[model samples]
Target: MFYPLRERISTWTTSQQTAEEETELIQRKRIQDLPLLRAAKENDIHLLKQLLEDKNCDPFQRGAVGETALHVAVQHENLEAAEILLDEAPQLINQPMTSDLYQGEHILTFAACVGDIEIVKILLDHGANLHAKDSWGNTILHILVLQPSKSLLCQMLDFLLSKDGGKTLIDIPNARGLTPLKMAASEGNVTMFQHLIQKKRKIQWTYGPAATMMYDISECDSMEDHKSVLELIATSSKSQAHKILNVPPVKELLQKKWQNVGRPYTWFLTAVYILYMICVSLCCAHRPLKPREDNVTNQRDITIYVQKTLKEAYLSGDDRLRLVGEIISVVGAFILLLSELSQAYIFGLKYFISHNFWRDPFNIIRICYSCMILVILGMRLTDADGEVVPMSAALVLGWCYIMYFARGFQMLGPFTIIIRKMAASDLLKFCWLMAVVVCGYSLALYVTFQTVDPQALGAFYSYTMTLISTYCLFSNLLNGPANYTIDNPAMYSPLYSSFCVIAFLLMFNLLIAMMGDTQSAMAKKKEELWKAEISGATVKMEQTFPKSHWFCSESSGNDFKETRYISLEEKKWHPFHLEEASGSSSDDESDEDVPPQNSQERNPNLDPYQEIREDITDRAEDRGNVDHNDNEIWEEELFEF
Candidate 1:
């Protein structure tokens, strides 16, 4: 097989880096022979205890693998050996690996990754650091996501969260800047993503007026996983995405950011779009007059076609208004076209297509309007006069697309969303049904009556004419089907009546019912749905023009400060800080900076961790959930261990 030059160079570079790292790890590690570590690796419980009994033996010493005996025991799943090693040297429980493969990873992380709850519990009980991170800054929860068994992973997460200070571990970012929740989202693990998000019960008031949540929007600034969470959920299921967006913390965060950053940009775009619309209207209204075909032209002939060039229109003082309008319209259309292309560039072509950008009614209208303006200018330049249809279309689309801009306003935003929802869903489905019915009925009626009464059908006895007649007859069904009376009592007459009954009475009623249901369902979540729209809008702005580009980048109210003050009631969430909240005499100025504790402080009643654990437990209740008997055996052995 052949490889590209770039691929070869990349592979060589990665290999070289790996080799250098391994060489460095080997140099730093003490690769001396150690019988205690060896005994643990071989699960020799008797030898491990005998070696630990020796006064000179260092049970805490790392062997060639740069891991203490506890790490080796955990790695090899030597439960008895691990317990003996821990008993010999409790400090070995938190000893980090210096080897290249597991560099910076502690013994407890190794035990967690080993998928043995007993070993994990034993290590944690021995005072292993819960906040330990590997070389990639991955916490125990982060490493657990890599395990194949989601059920076991969820179970482990629940167990860990039940421990002290585990909530803090949920949002801790890795070296690549991905939290466990974000990593799950990036990997397209819907269940894990949902579980991670719903389990986050942390909420605190920042030093400033702003509030903070476990899921920080600021952390999503990295280009690699900027939109990974939202994009994954949206692509997987729109309803799920909406639900996530509507979550109280997520919605509040988005709302605050929009007020600080997104509102200004959105207002600017609204102004520009408004200008484009005005320009379009002016160009359509003040068209350049055509030349007089006859010596004495009537009033109607003067506005027939815009046949004059810009220079000619300018020279003819009477038509100079049209020239100015065209110039402005052309500029506006070019600007709008660039904006449209920018969306494609920002989202990338694959995402833009997969998300069905073109299917959006607003995008379709805006695109058609912009393209039509350019087309009209091209036609004018090429002397293709009397082009009424394109100009009329541009006018209609330009004004109608105001609904897209209307999304920025609170009052009109939900109404526009409801309209868009119906148009995209019910209207589209209705149109497809109408096309099928019209085409099918038109063909059936055309074939049925053509051979029997060719002349009665008329001289234009074609499918196109038949389709038109059938469409017109659909309207006449309200008037009691008067055309059926004129027709002879025949088979075709009954067929026409049946077509009217099915297409008009049945399909039309179904469309009405669908629209009503959609409206009613959406009405319940109107405010939430509106917030979701605003959140989506802000997210787009955030991705396109990041905070780094903001001129007023002052970090006060705009910035979400890391230091947040938790109330006494909510102090259980920060189990480590309960003593601090207890008014201990500490000289920390940051703690003094916290506002006076509020008596009305409230704690979250819902325990998402417990709920998710129950859900996972119920799903994995039966052995039949596993595909293979081997899986059951593996799970059972691991759990029992």
Candidate 2:
């Protein structure tokens, strides 16, 4: 047993020596890497070359935090040094570069994040894996699209897509499950979104049936956001929402959404609307009255009396506590006004004017609400009647307050469409028809009876009397117009008898039929109508507010910025077609839409950059702007662009 233990002890000693020696070598290599790491960070190409030439030097070696020399080259934006390193040892292309700032980030991801096109191109040319992700499973394309930088975004997309021969490379999702297209939509960046659309068309990529993938549902922080996202997806160019999800009426549903409301900047407008409404309601609630014991009081006493009157009105009015209700109502109205004004500005002067701006039902209601407040204040100035609440104004305010629940109904989805159809469409039409028919009957009946009975309708053909008489003719208002027969036999004209029969038989029945048909038609196709409304709303929202900054802007870094902006002049997204981009003929029937897997590889002559040069060269020659050398410079700069 002692002899066996001696053997085990000898083996243990040997293993310990090996372990010690390995630790020493690790420490030595790390010490040696210090110079190489320094050279890489400083972009000293000569030092980098010298370091690599040493037989013991390992370019593949990780620094203390797993960053390779290539990662250093990318991290510092050292294109020249990166080139030399990549050239001398091309295998350094796909290093697992990690650092404190960019922990576990691959070299490709680092290059893309910097918006360094040339470095990205060089890395791609050297077979760097575009598919490789960082710790977050986000590819370089995912990082590039985090913000709206058309130049970097388009080029990076063009390069990867061209290399991959299609959209499959760029379609990779991030840790949050957002694909590049959905990310673009989420930001509401039109230019970048259009680029992605063009790429989709270039690849002829028909999106699959996964509507959830097309739009990130969880990105919607509110009901408004969800509605907007649904709309954006529905109306998008590659939107398979029509064929795949095939929801109907996408546009109408979105008209009420808060697409541009999430930004903190717009919250001020909402606050204003709320405040203005509150002030209006307070002013209308109660007015200051004269002191009861007015025996030639001093100015201070008058002031005190005025203050007390206002204070009581502001606190509680008529024992119903209407002061609190009035204050809240006016605040909401103020909020409504501010919101409307902001909407007008966002909609633009031309759009607002052309749309007959005030025709909106909300605008009409606002006008009536404002008018009632004004009239009440105006009447207050006269001693004849202090604080005569304009019944019309009070009535409108009552409706506006009650309609608060209606605003909350937007969250009900398809049912919201039904409500809108009933309130905005059917109700308006019914009111218009009623106004024409009722006014005609009111005029005829009032003219016939007013001369004979002066107080025939009890108010001598005043608006109130005429309205009451009109209602009486439709049905007996407590045996209404029939009471006139007891006073005088002449009250029954054949014309009056015919008018009552026609009004009840034809007008009421017609109104009922029209309203029924409208409601039934919508109910029959409620699902399709709701979807269509949502889709239209999604598309139209972008049309209305192109500058709306969506939520994805939160994660955007220096990596996703405009290194080279595609000018409005260059217009061409692809060398061939600013025309197609303009929705013109170039987009019409492209043979290249169905290109094969190796189309770009097979056609070296079809380089879009080269095509752009030829077009610019021809244009420059035509304008006599500069000789061939300047043209060459311009062409070179264009390629850089």
Candidate 3:
């Protein structure tokens, strides 16, 4: 034991010496990088200038952490020192860090990450490359995107927009294949996405064909990111989402993708749900018939009736079909439930429930019908014959769930959206108001009638009469109170009539106004609402597909770039065809539906020199007219750095 302890002590001694050696090496490097860099890091402006001018010290020399004097000044947030260093050695502005931790990071990257507008401007004025990349291939824009401060982010974005070629920087993806827009979307950074869109909106005209010189769509790298971007676009209320969705290229791509992938998946889901509905109907309709009391006169008659009922309920062909249908419905419900659970897991529980799930009338109906089916199944399993009420309600909800299929059609989609909105908002509020009125009036009538005939008046009779009469008032039957039986019709009739007229006029007019407002609001945004619905459906259907089918890989050849290339001008509608439609032209058709995996590609017909010259010209134009209308609309809780 003593010998082993001695050996361990010797090993510790050797390791300690190694650590000391490394420390000494770093200390020596700091010393060697001293004076100029040290002055900058310490914010000694006078010393920095003295060393730069008097001793002619090289400000470009890097320190232990691979930082030059300018880099050190930026990291320390010493603006004066940074300006001095840049003035002495302009080449130092774009010199990247040579150390492993910050290799390829220039002074501009530091300024961007530091959230200093002055330093950024100074560096750019000193001829710093705005497009320089860090070790991870993140540009200045990417670095700026990772900054935590929104005000600084806005300032930087504004400054960049004022610069030439700033808009084009947004479309450039880093090594990870994430453009600034896609990056913001992937991280759920709504404000960044909105600001970026505001800048893009000035240049990107949505109604026109996709002008490559101005804007281009970014593709998702993986299925997970694809799902995330789709989620952001679908649930966000920003007009930017609408703008991006309505881009002609995006619309065409979605249409092609829906036709190829979403259509078949939707059809399969529809068939399964339809089958489930049929089975539900069969199970409810084929329940055992109740025996008539008039026929059950004696023991022999009762016994005969019991045998016949048993034969019809359990042994007949319809009863067999009912059993099979129950099993099939259970399986279908289980499959749909699993689908929902997987979506919840993918998008998180809060999003799955709150965003669009509970608001959807179809989902609500499906849930109600499913719960009723489960209750019916449980009661049937116990050999109980009291599933009538649940079965009836379930049958009704099952039929109402057909509205889910309406979302696929453009005409039906907007209408369903309007109905859903009205029901949730206007109708729900109306019901609440009506509940208040009905409760108050019922209490008053109850008090009035109870005094007239305490023994004759049931506890709920006033409530029943009040509710029925109110409904009749809505239906325009003014004399509905006359049909009700009461201890004293005169006393009850006056109060009932007064309640009906007042409640009907107040509630119905308010409801009509509210519904009209809802209809008008939805009508104003009908196109946007319909597109959002279509995009949502497409995304949901996409999630059902396997990962192997996703287009995550890069394209091998230099095909046409961007999502799709339409003509520069919009095609005018005419009665006759202007050009011959070619069914066999694979090259022309390929450019329409097929999106390039690579974001950048060259047009073969355009001269490279001319294209570059035109691009330079376009970049030089002023971009001061950015739309800032969405600033107040977007939420301020942006992504963390």
Candidate 4:
């Protein structure tokens, strides 16, 4: 009996050891599956398949996180593994294995949050509910919309919209009591906001408590809150406000800043006026009666005498004062030209007057002084001593006329084209014309001095000679072994004169070529203008009449049917040319209908006149109503934050 008990005890110990070994083996198997589950969770499909091929592997088995292979595959967006798992075991897709492990996050919620549209589609295809919500009470659509990718959001939104009972998706609120529209507005997702608006329009959704609360908060007393509400409304509407908001407010602010800074041109005109007045006052103070024999030796003394004599003639009652006026003008002109060409006082005088022109009467006085410069040039050229040159009066006048006319053509030709292109309004054109006249007078004085004495030409003559020499050199440099000769009357060379004639012909040819180019540019510009008019008119006509009136019969029954056909054809072929001409005519009419306003007619203190006037009136009335006691109430309270 004792031997039998010992054998039974040994068998019991052996069985106990085998049971412990089996448990150890099971534990080893469980530990080995950890990496495999991790690989599955990371969407490493090859490693997962290898782990599944292990003889110890159970496909239905849960990991430490209670996430089965199928749940892991779906959560990681491994669509291939999901397909395989579904094929192998179709029951795992809907199984909520990780609800207890991952703070109640289901597999579908993970897929939606990650924006795995294909995985989400697969789950839906395999009998996953479209309206499935996570532990946070957030729908799959809500999670998908929150993903950063706009394209993914659009895809998910489209999918939800196409599904049965999908209209209620926008109505579903999160834990924050904010609907999808409010969330989209708050997040500033413009495209999502537009999508929501379109959905609301199609479904005719009534504004719920959440939308009403947002509206109420928008009207709160704080400026910050008011601004936030305006932004929210502007974002949510998907209307004109959205387009306007996209255009930066800083652009308007910069424009206002520039206006307040004032105009450089105005300051320039003012300085000119002041210098002119100073010169006039000095001339009036020292009026001279006659020219002196020593005037040639001291030109400044002659200039002062001539200026004084002109002032005397201007104030005199004698008829002979007109002839005296002419003589004074002639002397004054010669002096001014000499001054300009010699560059004697040009730089110094310009620097002196530069500071004074902008003040009051100086601006106007400077403009009048500019007129004197040209008058001086003409008089000097016409009144040179006949005895010195032995030229007749008519001959002198003819030369003067030719020189002045050619000078005017040279100055005015380019200026006219430039001014025409630059000035958009008639008033601006008039201002530019006056500016050109002033500039022309100053240039005449410069030219008169230049032609009379080559030595007196200064930098202006040097620059001209340099430019001509450079052009000749460049031509020689570009085309080797070419002869280019310039005129030198001092040398008395016939060859120089012949070369000059050839150069003149070549220059004339160039001028002709330039004119041709200008003509072509003008023609092109005209064609562009016509095309613009045609396009504008066509758009107006189309807007005036419906699409049906363009091609369809007027009869009610036939018009509807014909419009569909016409619209179909239009979609196929746009035919912009056919519509352009009519559009242009309509545009012309509209342009003509709008009356133009002058600067004087517009209120200087206000821009966007109607709104500014209303704001001013309201503020004035409010100020009038306020008493002394109200001032205390109006004072802002300082808050310590």
Candidate with the greatest lDDT versus the true structure: 1
By TM-score, the best candidate is 3
lDDT of 4 by residue, 1-641 (tens): 76889999999999989977876575446535576556665667677677666768677777554667777777667788887667656777666555342444556666666677788778778877666666667766566556677666776676655663535775677675556655655555656655554342211011211111001121111122222313333223233223222222212221221122212222333355344334433433333344543436654343423223323445554535444544554454455345333432533656434422221122222233334544443444554322212213322332222221121132433333332233323334444543443344334333433454444333224445534433443234322112234332332234334434434455445545555555555444443222222222223233334545444223211112111101100012334585456454454477666556644356666564555445434543444223334233323211110
Per-candidate TM vs. native?
A: 0.56, 0.39, 0.58, 0.28
lDDT of 2 by residue, 257-348 (tens): 33332222234434554555555445444444445554655643543232134333343345245545554655554655665677678767
Q: Give the whole-model CA lDDT for all candidates, comma-separated.
A: 0.67, 0.55, 0.64, 0.44
Q: Tell me the tens digit of each residue's lDDT in model 3 across 1-641.
A: 67898899999999889877875588456845588877887889888878989655666676776777788789879999988888877888768888744578777878877878888888888888877777777777777666667566877777765664534676677887767776665454556665774454323222212232222233421223453345556666565465555554445546555555555666666787787787778766656665554555565353322112334466767678677877887776666566667767887989878764766666667667777878877776676655777888887877777777776767687888898899888898888777777667666665665545543544325667656655555556644433246446455677767776777677688889999999998898887777777767767656656646634322211123233222223332435543445333465566556545422254555554665545534443423444343222211311110
lDDT by residue (1-641, candidate 1, tens digit) is: 33697799899999989988876566344432567766777898787778889998876687655777787779889999988877877777767889755688787778777778898899888888888888888888888876667776777777787674534777788897778876664554546655665453233222222323333344332222454454433333345445555543444545565676567777888898788678768767767665555554665344534355545656766466667767788887787778778878977978776564745677777678889988888887777865677999888888888788788889899989889989999988988888888788778777766764555544226888777777766655333233343464366667767887887789889988999999999898887677666766766776678678753453312222342211112121323576566865566657656677533344345564654445444444432322344345545643553
Task: Kindly give the stretch of ten consecutive residues in candidate 1 with the minimal lDDT sum.
Answer: 563-572
- How far in Å is the alpha carbon of 619 misplaced in model 3? 14
State the weakest 10-residue window (summed lDDT) of model 3.
Answer: 632-641
Per-residue lDDT value at 186 in model 4: 50
- Candidate number with the higher TM-score (2 or 3): 3
Cα lDDT for residue 394, candidate 3: 80
True-structure RMSD, every candidate? 16.9, 28.6, 17.9, 29.9
Q: Predict model 4's lDDT versus the native.
A: 0.44
Off by over 4 Å in 1: 1-117, 123-139, 143-177, 181-252, 289-315, 356-359, 447-461, 472-492, 542-641
Model 3: number of backbone collisions? 0
Question: TM-score of predicted model 4?
Answer: 0.28
Return the TM-score for candidate 1, rounded to 2 decimals.
0.56
Give the Cα error of residue 612 in candidate 1, in Å: 38
